[model samples]
Target: MMNDVDPQILARYAPRPGRHALLPSLTPQQQVALLCRVLHREGYNDHIAGHITLRQEDGTYLANPWELTWAEVKGSDILRLDAQGKIIEGEWNITPAINLHIDVHSARHDVSVVIHNHSEWGSVWSAVGRVPPIYDQTSALVDTDPVCYDEYRGTVEDSELGRAAADALGEHKWALLANHGVLVVANGIRQAHLRAITLEWRCRMAWRVNLLGGGVPLPAAVAQATGQRTDASGFPFLWEAMARDEIRRDPSVLE
Candidate 1:
């Protein structure tokens, strides 16, 4: 007997592999660099004003250095750093402001990746110092309404500011750094990248709605259901496609 497949189950299942699919073989550096380039094309590049870090099993972090633009990140450019933010590998320096990533890692052991960037639309909402409404269904791909850290304390060069930002983020998957940018934390790189991209999308749409002066909220129950479905995504379909696209554009990114 053939039973109708539950759509929910499908959402939670892995997608069939494409011709170039090879998820598990990718290294931490390669993953982080790929994320940078993917987001870079999405307008997340603000000079060298962003950082993406992946946590290691023993609490060290793999991060992009202060020298390279996200658009030009290659796997070889990733630096390994100790818990105390000391460089353990690679020949480049980390920003003292990396305390933001370090503190978030310290506070959330479940988080595998932390991405912060002064992205275009996200910065527009950040300047407004409020959580933008979830106008598009795609925007709800992120966890609910992102909380706002409606305070700017310069560039987070010290642990104090970083810890404060992490505290503000609480358990939310992403937060808007008012007058600055966005911070996203996820259990894996794929979810983190998706959240970062969707955060920008939501901000962009919200701005359009604001400019036109008409915006309607999705019912709370409907919005919650959408978020649950989006969160249930199991495979790396979005990340895998974006990554492969970047690789096709610049093979050097893998080196």
Candidate 2:
């Protein structure tokens, strides 16, 4: 067995500078590619209306430039933005949803990754106002009633709107933007993407099950236990495995 090195030593080697990288360690390029694959696989390109973002090593954020579809999105399309939503790097127009991104990232330190998508299933479930509780082990991916509603009156143009939306999400991992779509967040890009995918899966299942004469949902205790054990490896290992494969197969994704 390896002798345990001082935990402090390991900590100091983290992504940020000598402070041991208080922030996550993803490069701008990696953040972009992961965003692309996340949207691509989830079919968020249908309207090309979704976006993903990750905090860079310097506490800045990497997000997709406006109008870039998930499939056509290259890593070069990723724009670096400062805390005030000003572009710090890259050559692309910023999207209006930048405020939503900035508000959430600034408000929640636990969230290093954020994905906003208007998918068929996620949107469909959100349209219903009330999101049903966990219906299965997979549904428990939400963990502690993850879904919230915004009652979307219009685009989130102000910090108040964004804050309200974020508030609806509370401390949960996911939320439903009423009349708009869904947002998923996590401490890492891969984990956020995984939560987004799983949230949609859970939504789809809820819809299907509801069709069969209103199927029974999982017990609360079961959901709690399932959610607790779901991340035994500390992250969505399976989703990260696939994400790593995606990057491996298409190195150009980082171009």
Candidate 3:
């Protein structure tokens, strides 16, 4: 991918230390709005059904309020909710699925962001509990073995069901909610949003491969090595590119 680029030019783009220190400086509202724009750009917007939650330093979280479409989301539209899912600050009520997000966040301290979306290809792939393989470098950004939550207890209105889903997710960064859609969790909103969009793209690729007679899986050793390398350093660049593009397309999201 870096073909023909000068070594000096490539060096300028290399990952630098202290790059992630800026993440914590972002307010919860800014993080939520930026992620919402990223998801919307990736076509993950299922009207107002999808939600992204960013953990706050004060043990609360910021999530998109109900009735606001992803494309319409701005920093002002984000709702601050306590750990119990009660809206502490916002004009609109929380989505019923807030319980699900709350459970996952409570269970996984390592997870600073949770993204749940009924995205098109993600939903189609989840119908059969299929987790996409490491088909390419981009696909390898996700876990080689993503979790598949085979039990769909209607809506995740009950906290118990939410915990069950979190149990199904275990320690994986990606989860295919069987008969529903996909959920991606990560240490930051950028990574979570990047993984969600990557999952959907991987599923689309896998579906096409199945139609044209199944293809051979990458060798286990190669898959594992590629996954490790990509997972370590690929996502930030992808996230930055997408975020910049989204901001250029619609600068109002930052407002």
- Which window of ten consecutive residues has the lowest lDDT sum in model 1? 1-10
Q: After aligning candidate 2 to the native by TM-score, how far in Å is the CA of 229 from where it should be? A: 1.9
Q: Which lDDT values do the candidates have, in the order given?
A: 0.82, 0.69, 0.76
The residue pairs that clash in candidate 1, if any, are none
Rank ordering of all candidates by TM-score, starting from the highest: 1, 3, 2
What does candidate 1's lDDT look like per residue over 1-255, in tens digits? Answer: 001223565455545667433343677899899999999888798999879999998879999999899999899999999988789999888888899998888888878889988999999989989788888787777557788998788877767887889999998888999988999898777677778888888888889998999689667777778777666452236666788788889989889
* Best of the candidates, TM-score: 1
Off by over 4 Å in 1: 1-24, 232-236
Put down candidate 3 lDDT per residue, 1-255, tens digits, no spaces: 222233554476765875552222345686688788777767587888878888888899889988888888878889999988899998887877888898889889988889888887888888988776655656655546778999998867666787788789988888889998888888775567657777887888788888898787666687678666555444435666676677678777777
TM-score of each: 0.90, 0.81, 0.86
lDDT of 1: 0.82
As for TM-score, the candidate ahead, 1 or 2, is: 1
lDDT of 2 by residue, 1-255 (tens): 001223443465333655432223446576666657755676565566766888877888888877777766777778888977788998887777778888888888988888877877888867776676567777775456656685676776566787778777777778888887888887765456557767777887888888886777888887877766543223324544555667766767666
Off by over 4 Å in 3: 1-26, 233-236
